[model samples]
Target: MASTETVKVKVEFGGGTELLLAPPQDKRHSLTLPRKDAAGTETNVTFLIEYIRKNLITEREELFVDGDSVRPGILVLINNSDWELEGEGDYVLQDGDEVVFISTLHGG
Candidate 1:
């Protein structure tokens, strides 16, 4: 039988993205996700992004997610590598992986 272990990943927000979370200062999040969803598919970045938006974000959800993906100008990195190089939202999450979001947008 396959072990239905959870994957623990570290997620961080920066470059003004932290404002979406509570206190507007807390930026680091350690998350655990089931290895597979109810459909038996492995958890991916797309799922994690929504999970964070729904569960962790305290405000400004639009600043983080849009139309099933992260809004433009928000840079995502997986394990210190560019998410673009890691297949973007299709990249399957692994235990101990580090995901980071940095918003390039700034208030006027």
Candidate 2:
């Protein structure tokens, strides 16, 4: 069996995305996730997204997740850099990395 190491990261929500959490008020969280996935591969933002959807999101999952990544209109930032510059969902998380999710779509 492969040993699982944990990575700790800070996640923040904004642009109304904070309202999607269970409490709907807590927008920041320090999360611990396995460094390796079940397949014994290094985990990435994709894994983290699933983790948040499963463990943090309480309802209206569609608002947060669309398939394997976040739904359209949600911007992702890693360590203050646009996730697109960091390879988006493919970026391997580092300890203490700051991940921010901001939703750009909102009801008018």
Whose lDDT is greatest here? 2
Q: Report the lDDT tens digits of candidate 2 across residue range 35-99.
A: 99999878899999999999888889899999999999999999999999999999999888999
TM-scores of all candidate predictions against the true structure:
0.91, 0.92
Report the error of model 2 at residue 103, Å: 0.5
Clashes of 1: 0
Give candidate 2's whole-model lDDT.
0.90
lDDT of 1 by residue, 14-87 (tens): 99888788774678988889898788889999999989888878887998899889999999999999999999
Worst 10 residues of 2 by lDDT: 1-10
User: For each candidate, what is the lDDT?
Assistant: 0.89, 0.90
Name the lDDT value of residue 48 in candidate 1: 95
Candidate 1 residue-wise lDDT at 104: 88
Candidate 1: regions farther than 4 A off: 1-4
